[model samples]
Target chain A: MPTLRLLAILQTDCPTCRLITPYLNKLAANATPIAAVSQDSEKDTSEFVRQMEVRFPIQRDPGFALSKRLEVVTVPTLYVLDENDRIVRQEPGFDKTALNEIATLLGLAPVATPYDGAPASKPGCTSRHLEVQTEDAAAAALDLHSPRGAKASSIQLADSDDPYEYCYRAFGDALPVVPPTAERVEKMLRAAARDPQEVIARIPPCYGEATVEKIAANAVMAGCVPEMMRVLIPLARAVADERFNAHGVQATTHFAAPLIIVNGPVRRELHFNSRQNLFSNTARSNSTLGRALQLILLNLGGARPDAIDMSALGNPGKFSYCIAENEEENPWEPLHVEHGLARDQSAVSLFASEAPHGVSEHNARTARGVLKSISYALATVWSYRACMGYEATVVLGPEHVHSIHHDGFSKQNVREFLFENTGVPLRCYSGDDPGEGFAQRGLYKEITIDGEPCYQKFRAPEAIKIVVAGGTAGKFSAVLGSWASGPRGSQMVTYPI
Target chain B: MPTTLVNPMNERAPQAAPAAPRLATLQGKTVALLDISKPGGSVFLDRVELLLKQRYGVTSVIREMKPTFAKPAPAGVIEKIRGADAVIEALAD
Candidate 1:
């Protein structure tokens, strides 16, 4: 007498697989001779069995040998084999009607009911063996040992579905993103030249592992070119550094986001916008690279805008805040060079800052005139009365830099002059104001500026970070205030690319 | 016909740890008040400590503070609080 058996191919991560567990258990209870194959590691398979309360025997399909032989394209696929091992019936995904028909064919009662709470029908996840790969030169350029070894799981979308809409609905940052197709991700991994499975950082507050493959997927979604990986890989490390305090930056109610400042040869090599429209969407590298990091933080770090990210009145820079220093127009050493890196070495600096506060000093011909105007704006950082504990990045326009440079004022001189002159007048602190007593807290020193008693804005000149950027024609400079500074708060971090 | 894409998210298989068993009674127990270093957190914990000692009959109260509210309590702080029978953490805006 020939016997019959039901074969089920599934993966632990597939939602349909878990959904169909009860039906499979029902078949098993009926003595229908069911054999389930799991395309997952033994550890995961065992966990799945325990969690789903699986009743049937499940054999692990190492290397997906059986799945490939059976040409399985989706999980929760069912095959009814005859006594001769010939397939009599095949079912993909979950269909209530199809399940009932199979139950009837097996001489058993209906497996699923309308009251089962399961959907009438649902598509299954793509079989892991069917993951797509590119066949172009870009794919050939990838190191098979690295990118193919990437550990990120795969998701399958129907060929007719709109990938853009699907990606936006599922994985977007409130914006349409390029679908991170496997081909595009592989191309990005090629540029990284690192193990795609390597964990770059664990982003807070969820502390998700920012693996190289995951970063590449985010980069693809942000529409970044392959070359941008050079900067992004290091930028990830910088943000994860304890001194950067990403948890504080992401969770604080204050308006703060990680600002990426690029310097050195890579800036020019990537055509990063350092001159005209420095902070705007003028350069692809500037726009996409900045956007990539934001996506990484959102997707991998789990800093969803409506969830863990509690920033009130979030800065527009959160969309994309990246700029390269205008090295040619800068009078002092570039930001990277100032940070102890050689002039030719490329590096990325991460700073937790609020939106840029623009200062129009168009008429200031002399360095002192420009510095004085900037000091007034600098005093307003954090709050006019709030002093110490905060830092600011002074992004000077090239025109302003030229004016200061021509006046024989070095970068150190500019920092010291700003520190000495930038202060809140003692009279501004009204007795009834809540922040009035900050000056007496011993956190700030009272200095006489213009013969008026004032509370100094910064504890030290080093608190002011200056970088020359923006169009050579514009007289507008900007100040980005820090969230919180020092050991307890976020500190600026620089990493070589 | 289906198109495939890599998952951009970090796959986390979080093992659910069981919560600590509830104490039957606070009598003769030592309660730890943890202030997360946020403003007003200490004031809230102070009241909690008083209530635990006076009303709940907690024999002793251990007052501890996290270095900052922005991150989790350091391991040293957690170890210090582990000696207490129960801990009440104050989170103040």
Candidate 2:
């Protein structure tokens, strides 16, 4: 089987593809042997070639499968591959100069088009492979071709008429999934630069090997488009880290979930919403990304709710909890930068956290006042004293950030202030102090050992992490406390994206 | 048109850990009660401590509480209680 050197990709549904069919025939007639790749069914392509009176062999690309690999976003795309299959000269769309250049490359006369005497140029229609139908179709186009028949574990429900059968039979996370078909999952895998068989980590409970291909299938079911694999792959790796203790996070009955905070260039590249509705369902990156991780937990990690995941009052974030740090406007170091990544490097910070509890502090005018408003919220983390040495995230909105930044407060300054201002009085630690029966069960009595009632809030300045996100209009902040922080539970893990 | 998706889950059967051998009796043995960081977990463990002392004839008892309830206990705490003849982990809201 000799590999063809010159290839012209087309679709029968495109008028430009039809207009250029004769020009392609003329080139083939000149002994150049230019192969026209049709992105249509065999019947439609044969009909097109028959109608055009062209004798050239038209190769069939059913479902535009091969066209997707050539990065053919529009029809009438052309590629001049070398004998070694390297694309030496490629032209996208129907530009006159590009067509003439191709004609020169094939040693043919400058090809004339249907509009050569009129406008001398024309625009081409969209390619069949890149059709986006929904508003949430914000993921970027994968720049590689999907392999044909590359699936191994796909379950074909041939007799079942219902397409959503997988959703009900334990594969679904109590929500309808987008059905991770082989074609869609292949597209998802193509988005990542990593190998599909590259094992990211061992998912817990089930301890399944999470290969790039396995995670891609879950990302597809979670409604993530192909490009989201950029964010999801690293996000999956962070949680799968044993230091993050994904197994403990899943087995615990606490209201814990993976809260992902994006940083650096990938946040903007993926269009994550760090402004209004930052915690709400506003952006496809925010919603589907966290959901993809959760789906991985269900499918690979085996942390299904009402089973291994025994949250007493499960937070809504279990559905999806991802956000980007407003790195553009942040006055302090971004989460990733503080965690040893370069300032410009893209990374994800993972925390085993409960759902966010909003801190509505509308009246604070000073930086100290803002910290004070947040300190009270920090005091309520994990039952006011039962869970000590835990962590919490204070998400400051743009308005609060402006105030804090104006007051010359760094992240360390805020953490110190919150740590000092947040703890309960020593009286609460003892049983006799205020209906002190709680001290008997195993509360840390040595946590506060001062002569007076001065108690310490967080274990260290590091535990009170400050992240800037949310809308600029609101003066609100939020507190997302840790879920059994320290070695006793899952610690935070951040990875460069 | 209907979509055909591949299974993302790991179908391999999870290797189950063998169960610990049951203790025959609690007579003259030290039993440790572990309290996770939640609120009512300690009260539950306190009651269990009384039952072990009164009914089981345990000679000694050690009670340890995690610094925080939201996570697993630290290794140091676990190591301290690992030597006990019997152990009971209590969990509550």
Candidate 3:
């Protein structure tokens, strides 16, 4: 007699699925007995397993491949496999009473694991699962449920019992979505003036076609309004810009991306928070717009985490890291204006940034004095180590900005001042222990300065980039360092929307 | 017309014989050592070069480098590799 391996593929939300999983678990617990799974409602299935204390392995098939392969048209399908893993008995929908009959055929004892399931954890304001505010709740819920490409007409609303909600939550998408209703999407589609099918950006090596409509759908999912799409289209173009190098940013194990910096009237027009918590999720414009770009990158460009992006420790920035420049506070010209764009024109500048390091100081009273403090803080090896020919971005808060401005130094003067002071001495660049294995690798070279053998040190002054950002409250400045030196240096590229 | 169920015997392949062992031919091949100018990248290439020189007598080496490590590999890198026998990329540390 051969052993039976019943692969129970069931949906977690189905009442019938919940009823039969325990018995199936018992069937699978034996050596070469069975393999039961709930492909749909993975959250409920995981919760069910935790609650029932089912020790048997229950694989989730979100892609619905295994279900389609076994011709499973219904939930709780049990496929009895022979010793060679061939399906001998295939049946859709679970039946606990049939276990005895099926057990006799396979010659196995029915041993159901005792139910000792854990309760659901209390939801709190942990960074992972922050609740959407009530005002934005309806829209956010719709965004998740009727994701952009979902059926346009009469989009299904997520009720308390919607299985899709649980599925979305388990997949790390929130429980609800503001479905892109046909009425809303059509309005947005009309704003574009191009055919919905018109291709905007060609996603790399996979060569997936991303049309304007598809990008609009993703924008809808990210909770972006249609007018934002004006900015989105060009921003997508910037990311796909051959020099922007989206492919290398996505493919490399190192940290890099297209950091969108908004300048001119659009920052104020879109209500992009250049103020308090500018980089954080305080403002809808910053959050959704940044999220829209990331979703397009993840879904359209196919730069999924751990797949194309092999970041050692991927940061929150990978989700979405974008901000607006505080143009009003700066004494010097705006970033776009500095890059040759008109002062009145709206533009977006893109740069590849590493995660930012926050430097806060309270004792400084004046701008140049504060920058000296900031320079000391910046020059400190912990936040940023000066690299030859590499660039770092300094985002200044309003307090630091006001302090610097009151001292009568222009932004250019400030940038030059930072460049001159924020670097370690030439002696420190040499390896303290030259006998170290890495030092012996001949990676670091020595220079004969004035006929004496000394270590080549001091990064070029242009490497330090100072840009003003943040709220009007604290005396804090954030520094984002360059991961590697580039041939073109860190030149800012701008696109006017 | 009736469908005929005729079984065709194996005529192309002779009676199953033990397959010959396969070996990689990396000897006497001119290998290109390309660098992107990053410290770790150059170090990794040097190690590969050492192995190729010490173990194998393939001494004809061609070396080139991209100006900066952060940038993409220059246009000629792939063409250079395409002409060689096998190309080993030292991506990063």
Residue-by-residue lDDT tens digits, candidate 3, A110-152: 4321111101111111111122233421211101001012111
Q: Give TM-scores of chain A for all candidates.
A: 0.70, 0.66, 0.60
True contacts kept of each: 0.80, 0.68, 0.01
| Rank list by lDDT | 1, 2, 3
Q: List the residue pairs that clash in candidate 1.
A: none
CA lDDT, candidate 3, residue B32: 79
Off by over 4 Å in 3: A1-184, A203-208, A380-386, A430-462, A488-490, B1-23, B53-71
RMSD of 3: 25.4
DockQ of each: 0.47, 0.31, 0.01
Residue-wise C-alpha lDDT for candidate 1, range A322-374, written one tens digit per residue: 98988889978888888888999998998999999999998889999999999
User: Which predicted model would earn the best lDDT?
Assistant: 1
Q: Point out where model 2 deviates above 4 Å.
A: A1-152, A385-388, A426-453, B1-3, B17-93
The lDDT values for all models are: 0.84, 0.75, 0.60
CAPRI grade, predicted model 1: acceptable
Per-residue lDDT value at A267 in model 2: 82
Q: Mind giving the per-residue lDDT tens digits that candidate 2 earns over A329-397?
A: 798898888888899999888888888899887888899988788887898887775435678988889
lDDT for A175 (candidate 3): 20
Q: Which candidate number maximizes TM-score?
A: 1
